[model samples]
Target: MNIIFEESPKEVADSATGFDLFQDRSIVAIKVNDELRDLSHKLSDGDTVIGVSIDSDEGLSILRHSAAHLMAQAVQEIFDPAKLGIGPPIKDGFYFDFDVEEPFKPEDLKKIEKRMKELVGKSQRFVRREVSDEEARELMKNEPYKLELIGLKSADVGEGAAEVGAGTLSVYENINPDGTIAWMDLCRGPHLPNSRTVGKSFSLLRSAAAYWRGNENNKQLQRIYGTAWPTQEQHDAHLERLEEAAKRDHRKLGVDLDLFSFPEEIGSGLAVFHPKGGVIRRVMEDYSRKRHEEAGYEFVYSPHITKSNLFEISGHLQWYSDGMFPPMKLDAEYADDGTLKRQGQDYYLKPMNCPFHILIFRSRQRSYRELPLRMFEFGSVYRYEKSGVLHGLTRVRGMTQDDAHLFVSNEQLESELTNVLDFVLGLLRDYGLNDFYLELSTRDPENPKFVGSDELWERATSTLESVASASGLQLVPDPGGAAFYGPKISVQARDAIGRTWQMSTIQLDLNLPERFDLEYVGSDGERHRPIMIHRALFGSIERFFGVLTEHYAGHFPPWLAPVQVVGVPIADEFGDYLQKFADELRSHGVRIEVDHSDNRMQKKIRDHTMAKVPFILLAGARDQEAGTVSFRYRDGSQENDISLADARIKILKAINDKTQV
Candidate 1:
């Protein structure tokens, strides 16, 4: 029989399986008619089949999924009462949730990993079989979580979708060499052929408590995370990268450098910047303001809270109420007889600044001259983030967004977006983040949460895509990831450690102006609806600060360092000389400090270097006589006998150039 193989016709024997057609051991699975299936799947005449390499994205997912099943079987065997929840492969790893009486300790992971290795060595075959709903229920009767997932087979159950989808029910059996089922799981899988194929490159990472289905209202389940790779070298490389990431953790660096803190009494996700942190933030904002001013952006300010009606008019209350804080009732009046005389109004902390900017645009009538009016603000907004989801500074409840709204005509949409993208990239590069790619997040057609007509969405999405593509940066599609109002292009920046952070977003919004009834007098003498573009360069100041902190590992550049230059005297006598030099630099607006403490000069140098001071000026009797000081940099390199005048110029140049000295 002739069948299409990898887009080409090939002759194969009758009743041949993918295993028989593709004899390569690396081809773990096959795509039959665009659907992933196990290698054991039988082929039909004229069927199109393509091999799924074990190193490809889809192949890795299948390998990890099979690893997840192996780990689950090991867990159940080790812990008799553990009930299974969803086990899905995520980015670079996989996790399985279990309802256990006690949380898993570190030792538990070791045992599970050992059992998995033992199972892998046994070369058990993974056999898939389709069953009816009734049979699935009977097989998974003891697992209440699996039973619940079976009931939600026709619905979208988030991560549990990996287990049960709107299709025929199937289960994977780990068949031992003795022709008996060692274990079984309800899954929609195209897993590896056997346990040995999972390889020794897999490992159990750690365990954490996660709520089932990611809902606080649901029962908490103990989730064991693991990672699998096609080779041991790749697994070791991933572990090394993780170790480096831990060293660069912003929270730890923040505390160690005395930059910021999150006081428990204050809140869960609110961060308080110290004086040092404040210095960096002020410089960042000041530079941004200067750039915006040069770019024809007008500064604006809005209150932190507003009446709930504003959000209602903007469709935030209708579509994004879950993310907004609960409203506060106020301004109600009562009669002396305790009877209601006036109704109360509900006020809420503003979750976004776009609505306020839209109101400002509607406050006045303008002509084509002001059609591309750009309003900028460092607006503080509040969000009601669940406790479990909040991280150190990246995910916070309150943050200040470097937000701007551009009101442009239809003709100005593409150009304005192009300029915005350029401006965002340039500014981010100014802060030492140069590597970037663009992710276009478009609305999901099947989701009801997205507003706006299909025509408007397509126009906005296509225009943004054009702007992004024109910039020559790699553009990735993120379908179903847009905001409710419109599509947005987010700048994903890679930090020093190669981790991507979403730094800036340029959203082309046409629905907000329509909702707010915003208009501008065009050159044709008719009022026309203006298009609103939402742009946030840094996403949020607090989040950006954290990212920069991690990106540089607390060793900020000379321009952004809180204490740029510190003067150290060989003894207490030379303190006055170094102080005079520091005074001269201070006059040039340099953040210089002279250490005249009782500690030795070496101690002060060590202390300041530990604090990540960019430059250390060490003056001694010989240097004082020569009117010169030695330059000690953060990397411990030194320049001896630099004249005071020359040192001043070099220091200023480093600061002005934003060099990582």
Candidate 2:
């Protein structure tokens, strides 16, 4: 018999098992062919095997999922009324939901953790056994959630298909040394060998209320989150990263810095930027516009609402109607008898800017000379984001997109797309983001939602793939992830904390132009359809603002700071002198302010520093007499009594150069 291990094939005994070959304890599981199997799985003839180590991503998921089951057992032991729910592993951790009578508080989490520690210390063995639906229901009759799952399994729908559709249901039971059962749960699992393996390197994060299956209409249950790692050092590192992420959470920093707020009156997912936040947004938009103007993009404008026919022509009504808000029936008419005279038209808030841009292209005749025509707009779009998915700024319903559409001839498609990629990367670099990679989203063959012929899609997809590959950056394939009308190359950027954010997208659309009957006259004097390239560099202003806030940890560079320079007088007497200096800076188009509040000098400095001001200019006795101001940087570094001439030059140069301090 031929057995493959570590990518090498050799003859071995058919009776050989994963545990016999993979003697290293770090090898948690075995991949037989393409399927993950337990280490105790026996090897068959002509089998390809690979080791799954504990430190790998898949290994960590299994470890965390096993921890989730152990935690569920502990919850049941500590809380008599607890009922089991689905437990799934997520990025960096796992969470399990419970249908308890009351929510778990902070103190309750401590009790659960204590019980978990005791369970781990028991060194119990985990025994996996398969049972019929009737037997499983009878065994777990007391647990309503489990019984409901058994019923779902019988019907083979929802999560039940995964729970038992494999022809049988499996339950994992913790066994005592005396061959007695401790605890068990219904799950489709490839768990760690024992509860003891889910060791001390795990911590319960927090508990929150979540609707079952993510449907708000379903019953809400309490969910507990936890993370598992291979070592204590790794666990500590994960915790430290979580702390840093919390500190940089944009929602908290937004309020702490007086940036933005979500008003209840304005409704959920709608934001109102305060004066400070408005300044930051204005700076961002202005800089982007300047860059676009230099890049030869013609600025365009469109209305907020339009007749539903536009979306219908763009095929958005068929493929994307669910994401759009319901339409408003307008232009109603009535006769003297109060009977309907004429039917009304349905108008919808524009969920996208592409259809409108297409209308502009079709409004007039075009020659090949204008084939590479680019149209730009800061178009605000609205999406019906469910309340459960909406977050601060990042996931808002209303957002202005820094969108552009480029039309090019078929022969010029590849070159124009290459240029667009370069333009996207360069503009993003100007915004202080350098780390990036490209994801090529292509059409799914099985889904009929994608419009256009295979030939058109292939040409569009290959052109984008070639352009993205030629950029010499990593390209990840996203199967079945393309827009219904075209394929897109989305730019994935890494933030300061090593988190990736979808910053920009450049899509190659061939269907919309054809659907809209957009054309240009070629040198051959023949009318030919143009290829439309849709690009959104910022994705949305609200989301970009959130990303920037968290990326910079609310300490924006001098160029983008809401208040570039703040004038702080050491004494009340020097207020006049500081105000004069602030006037000079303000005249230079700098965002400057003089603190005239009744707070003490140190208190004023503290207040401005907490606001994350880039520069704090202090004027005192000798400095005011010397006609110089002291410079205080965000990092608490200082330069005293710099000449006014040099100070202006230094500050102006930093702002112009976009320096971070």
Candidate 3:
């Protein structure tokens, strides 16, 4: 019989399965008729065959999934009667959850890894079996989570969704050479062919307590996370990257550098910046304001709360109500006889700044000369983020966004968007994030949430696509990821360790103007609707501060550093000289401090160095007499006995240039 295969057409000698179709060891699974299938899947004439290479995404997922089974088998060997939960492959790694007697310790991971190594060397075969629901219930009766998963197939469920989503239940058994089953687990798997295929490049990173199916209200299970690479070189690279990331973790550096803290008194997802952190934040905002002012932007301020009618007119009440805080009823009046005199109105904490900007645009009638009315604000918006998703600074409930909106005529949309892109990229480069690519989020035709005519949608999307492409950056498409009012182009930027973060966004809107009935008189003496372009450069000031903290590993650029210079006197006798220099620098708007404690000069240097000070100035008796100060850089290099004037020039140049020390 003839077959259409991915690489080449071929004929098989026997009535065969996918295993017979491709004998390459790297071919871990098969895609039969465009659907992923196990190696043991039976194939017939007229069927299409595509090999799943072990290094490809689908193949890696299969390998990791099979590795998860090996981990489960290992847990069964070392741990006493461990009950199975779900084992699935995640991005860059895999995890297996188990209902063990206790939380896994560091030693437990070592023991399980050792057993996994032994099992991988066994070259065990994975035998697949299909069973009726009754038989599956009987087989998994010992595992309550498995039975619960089985019941969830009809009622909607979680971890086991992968197990029963295909309309049937299947089990994979780790078979020994003697044809007896060593272990078994329920899965819908297109896993690696055998245990030997999962080589020695896998490592169980760590273990933690996780709620079953990620539901906090459910029972917590012990989950072990592990990563597998195609080669040892790749594994080592990943481990090195992990090390760098841990060193740059913003939360750790924040505390060590005395930047910011999340206090319980202020509630979860709310943070208070310390004096030092506030200094950095103020510098960031100051620079941003200067840049926007130079770019022809008008600064605007809006109240933190507004009547719900504004959101209702903007359609945010219909589209984004889920992310908005519940309303506050205010302004109700009562009579002395207990009869209601006036009705209360719903006032909501503003979750966005666009509606207020729209009001500003509509407040007065204007002509085409004011077409691109750029309005900027450091708008503080509140979001109702779930407690489970609250992260340090990056994900917060209260954030101040460097938000702006441009009201441009429809004819000026393209050039206005082009200029906005240029402005956004240039400003971000100032913050030291130079790596970027554009992600175009277009409307999903199948979804009704997006409100716009096809002509308007196509025009807006094409304008953004051309602008992004013209910027000479790669563009990735995100289908169905746009806001309800319009499509957007989000900038994805890479940090020092190559992890990408969504930094800024440029959204072209047509629906909101119509929803709010906004208009302006055009050159032809007729009323025409204006286009709205929403842009958020920092995404939020708090999130950007956190990213920069990690990007520089807390050694911020001199201009943005909280404490730019610290003076360390060799002894109490030299304090006056250093204090004079500190005062001079302070007069020049530099943040400088002179250490006059009884502690030795070396101790003061150590303290300032620990704070990540950009420059440490030293004044010893000899240097003070010679009218020079020693310059100790953050990296511990020193320039001995530099003249005071020359040292001031170099420090000022570094700060003015915004160069990293």
Candidate 4:
């Protein structure tokens, strides 16, 4: 058997064959075909090993990881620091933590970044050396955190795991060509050959205070964040995207538009919609209700707060208590005190609508006739999100979900899932989002946090995969991304600006059914478990509204516009004509307004345009005499002297077709 070792000069094994050594030391990531594994994993013949460089995404991660090391090294060089903390690679970036004299300032960041660049230019070589655990502890004497890491490493390599043979634990020293070592880090690395390989595609982002290892009770350390890319162009493009993202920030837009606000007295993550915002929300919900009704869906409602026992049976209380609002306490008399007491006394604000929907389904004994029961609700849920993590409507503590659950037989699972996916895709398309991708989130066999048996998980996951395949969806699999109860198919939609947002999800759950004891009588006359498919086309109404606002730049489509049309009169003499025209449009269920606030025609037109009203109907004595009204659109297109009826027809058609004007 061949035993793999990272950066080892020679391979030691029970029985060895011809050893094939990698030629280049710049291999940042070593993967076996599609699977990414740590570089220390063993390899055998016929293994297709792909070497990652500084140009690939994985390569950038490795570079960023090394850059984090460089940051740590630089901080150590400048400040005779107190304690070290963990530094790891994150999405598009890396971060390192340190206990310092005070919070790091912007100027200090500039100096640290400059020092990092200098170290990169020096092209320090990384040399790996193996040492025993006792020796490692002795070497890392100054770092108490390192000593703790050493202990964890010892535990990981202890007992039954030792049968795999204890591989050499090593540290890498950054050395100069003159044979003097620049600096070193205790690591188990297959790092890039030199500091220069980290490339110029790196930048220090920001600093934040974090617990030493993410535990709140632990001492806080200042974390410095940085981003790395494969090339200068990619880096610049990313930075530009970040700038655009900042400009498109919904919080800023919400304030500027006066759509929503969160007062300090009102608390965080709970926004109060302004009149304009309420108007917009009303229009959106009305449209959704109309469409859903047309599609044969029945709306239902449930209480915002439920008893603690309801969630206890649903397994949410045990697993998701951290994200939930603290349970309301009961008075001593209300509490169970040895004497026989009525149950179901504790209360909780609902975090999800699935359990309530399931309860609705279980309310009656179901049969084969109602094989695929689809129930929908625009249900509002409250999740106590940490204040630090809350950001605008997208990440809110309280929001309404366009949620639904399908109770289908095992035989109907595939077709039902397909239909749900198609419906979700169609809904997103109606909202002008055509580009989308699908992800199949499956359970990790090694992870015990997930509920249900392996057989049930396999069946649920396989059914979802089949449905996705049949739907011809280009699917990607995300292991360990499944919900605690079951697997799911998530839909990610890309907007006009090429920004992707997770909008829809279709999850197949067997665990919840088992937990809730949900079943249906099958054709064979035996009670069988009904596969529960939890779906939410629009993850959250508030979040989707925020996304749509940014997607269209607040220029909503005619059907969804808070005000579809605004009537403008050149002078008070044409006020009657303007009101008459607005009334005609409003009669057809259109949101039309007549400008009678003494604002000029020009100012009215500008106001309507700024508010993103689709069409502006301008009336003047000349147009009124000719039996016409001047029609203009937000995009500055004018249809001068158009008949009022003709203008109304065009606007009605646009609204009916749900077209952006």
Candidate 5:
């Protein structure tokens, strides 16, 4: 029979399967007609097929999904009555949810892992079988969550889509070496060929409480998180990275360095910076302000709350109301008779700063001369983030966005976008994030949430694409990731440990201006709608702060360090001498401190080093007599007998150059 295999037409046996076509062991599954299918799937004439390598992203997901099924089987074997929920492969790992009689303990995870290893050793084959909806319901009658997923086959089941979607239901039977079905699950999968291929590279990390399908209103199930890799070496490397990531966790560093806190009394997702963190924030903001001013951005301010009518005009109320906090009804006046009262208006805490900037632009008529007017604000906006998703500074309810809005004529949109991209990259580089690529977030035509006509969206998307392409950076397409009103180019930055974070977003907006009736006079003396561009360089101060903290692992550069220098004396007699030197450094705008506590000099050095102080100055009677101080760095390297004049020059130069010491 004739078929297209890996994009080339070839002749194969009529009964050929994907497993028979791809001999490489690494090719775990096959994509038949663009749909992922098991290697055992029989090929039909004229069918197109491609192999999926075990190390590829799709292959890893399939491997992890198979591992998840293994884990679920193990769980059911040990914890008899454990009902299964969704098990999907995430970025670097997989998690399975279970409705168990009790929460899973660490010991339970160990037992589960042991059983999974035994199952892997048994070399069970994964066999897929298609079933009708009623048949699936009957098979999963004892499994309440599975039955629910079957019922939700035609609806949006969120993560449960991995199990049962709006298609034919299928069950994967884990068959033993003796050709008997050992365990099974209702899943739409392209899983690994056998349990042995899952190998010993998988691990169960931890377990926690999770809602079924991630809905807070649903019953909470126990979720066991795990990681799986094709090879042991890769698995080991991932575990090491996880350990390093834990050590660099910003939330922990926040407490250890006394930088910030999320006080429960103030509620979740709101952070209060300590004095040291405030100092760092101030320096960050000050430098950003200087850069914005140099880039011809006008600083503006707006109230925290605005009437709902403003957002309604900007289309935010209609499209983004879910993210917005509930409005406050205000300004109603009632009669003493408690009869009729004036109608009150709803005032919402601003979820974004663009609409306010739009109002600023609309406050006065403009001409072509002011075409590329830029407005910037360190605007504090509030979002009603769900409690389940509320994390540290990275995911907060209240944040200060380094937001900028540019109003330019349609002819200047591409140039302005290019300039904005350059400015964003340069500013982010100044803050120590140099590695970046651009992601183009275009509208999903099928999604009704996006505004604007097809012509406008195409123009804006193509314009932004041209600008991004001109920058000569790798551009990735994020289909359906755009805001409701516009398409955007988001800068993805890789940190020290090679983790990517979305740093800045430059959005080209055509709908908002039209919605708000914003217009400017052109050279032809006709009123023309100006295209609005939304840009956030830092995304948010709190989020960037957290990113920087983790990127540096709390060892901030000398310029951005909270306490740049600390002085330690070998003995009490030398205390005044070190203090005198600190005073001299402080006069030059350095953040310097002298340790005057009763602790030993070694303890002081250790304490300041742990605090990530860039420079620790030490003075002894001998050094004092020599008119020199000892230099101690965070890495515990030391240089003794450096003259005070030379030391001051070196310290000042590091801070001025923004160099890491």
Candidate 6:
């Protein structure tokens, strides 16, 4: 009998249990059917496969996931009878869920680390095998979470899921050289070559409680988080970066500086700003409003609550409803009807400001002269954030956005974006944040959440990238970070402590104009849709204020400090003299305070220093006679023997220049 064999590329090799076929020469991992498995899995002819390369994110995820399994295997070796849940890879790391009786103490982590090292030394290999659903269920029956996950497949992907191309599932097992299973997980995995190949590239970071499947209603499971890199040096660098992040944690600084408080009685995620914090926020907003006014932006106001019908048309009801607060039903009695009846009308607190601003633009027909119309508003919006995800002001439920919308022609999009980026960077620098990076977030063609057509998305994304490049900014790609309606450019600022905070965004919108049917009469005498650019320089006033407090370490600059100057008279007699000097400073547009609280001059100075007052002018008989005042800074620098007028001039210059005193 004569057998026919087809010629193929040199990159592929013939495999067993098949006709002429090419082996995965470059694919580090392969997705077989609905499951991800190692490329070593013997493939049948025409098996659906998606190759994963070493440089790809999916490949990295597999490496992290495999690291997580190794961690669990190590824990089981040290602590026998330990229950295991699911271990999945997340952004930049991987976490394993465990149902241990007690929380894994810090000491427990050390022992687990020791065992992991031993396992890495053993140079064990990860083996894979194909198993049916019944076989998988029997193997994972001891693990409730894994069994639950297997159950969720049918539910998560409902009947007629075949339309989505979800086929039957399979499982892979990990085995040791003795052919005894070291550990096994119910996962779709395309892992690394073996334990020895995993390299010295992972570290156990922290452990916390996470609800199963992220559902609070489910039983809470202990989660061990760990990060793995392709190289050991990268892992060490990441650990160092984490240490830097902890130093910039706003919550720690908030307590140290007495800037804000989140009392449990007041509620989680809701914060109360202290006097100092309020002053910082006021100055920030006041200066922002001044700048916006100078830039020809017209201010507008909108109510916090709106009828549900408005959101339904804006597509927020269907897409972002989960992030919004639940609606309240209006009764018939409140609607001018005596009978108590359900009106079937719902009202919701606004979660964003764009829809309201769109209504303003559509209130009247615009003309070509009104092109590039810029409208600004310091709008406060509320979101229903999950308590588990809430942090300090950075992840709050209520905050105000320095929001604006620019209605311009498609031809004006690039210039408008350029101006917005420049304006954002300029204002940020005023607060002493000079370093920045730009992220151009474009639409994901696979995701249907985005509203605009592909053509519009391409035009908007290209325009944003061009503007960012022209501005000489380092643009990074943020896939799937775009808003529901359009792509955006996120401006990330590095603070004084070298920490990055996402404080500004400029988004190009084409969906809203079409939804609202807004148009402007162009020079051609034809009704044309106006391109909208939505931007927020300070993403939120509360969040930015929090970041600023930590960035300055609570020692704000003179111009922005609530109390720019404090006068501490040496004795009771000199209080009157110092009061006059304080009044003079106040008249010069400085926020000055005179301390005569019956405390000693030393005590008063200490109190003012604690409050972070930029300038402290001490007056006594000797200095008062010479018409001079001894000046000091919050940093303990004293410029003695200076005339009061000269001291005032110096203080005013610092405040005017917004310098750190």
RMSD of 1: 3.8
Model 5 agreement with the true structure over 8-82: per-residue lDDT tens digits = 999999999998897799999999999999999999999999999999999999999999999999999999799
Worst 10 residues of 4 by lDDT: 157-166
Clashes of 6: 0
Per-residue C-alpha lDDT of model 1 across residues 164-195, encoded as one tens digit per residue: 76799999999999999999999989899999
Of 4 and 6, the candidate ahead on TM-score is 4
The CA root-mean-square deviation of candidate 3, after full C-alpha superposition on the true structure, stands at 4.7
The full ranking of all candidates by TM-score, starting with the best, is 1, 5, 2, 3, 4, 6
* lDDT scores of the candidates, listed in order: 0.93, 0.87, 0.89, 0.79, 0.93, 0.79
Q: Is candidate 2 or candidate 4 better by lDDT?
A: 2
Model 2 lDDT per residue over 1-661, tens place: 7888889987878688777886677778788997776676778988999988889887888788888888888999888789887787788888888999999999888888888888889877776678988889878888777778776774644432334445588777888778889998887666777777778898898999988766789999999998888888999999999999999999999999899999999899999999889999999999999999998999999999999899899888887798888999999898999999998899999989989988898899999999799999999999999888999999988999999999999899999889889999998887888899999999999999888899999888988999999999999999999988789999999999999999899998868888889989999999999888999999999999999999999999999899999989999899999898789989999988999888899998888888899999999999888999999987888999998888899989989998788
lDDT per residue as tens, model 3, 515-619: 878888998999999999999999999999999998898989899999999999888889999899889989998899999888888888889998999999998
TM-score of each: 0.87, 0.86, 0.84, 0.78, 0.86, 0.73
Q: Count the backbone clashes (under 3 Å) in each candidate.
A: 0, 0, 0, 0, 0, 0
* Candidate 6 ranges beyond 4 A from true positions: 1-74, 83-103, 110-205, 210-221, 226-249, 252-258, 262-267, 331-344, 570-573
Model 5 ranges off by over 4 Å: 1-59, 80-86, 98-107, 127-172, 186-193, 208-222, 230-236, 341-346
Better of 2 and 6 by lDDT: 2
- Find the 10 residues in a row with the least total lDDT in model 2: 156-165
Q: How do the residues 467-564 of candidate 6 rate in per-residue lDDT, one tens digit apiece?
A: 99988878899998898889999999888767678889998887878988889999999999999998998888888887887788778899888788
- Candidate 5 Cα deviation (angstroms), residue 35: 8.8
- The all-Cα superposition gives candidate 5 an RMSD in Å to the true structure of 4.1
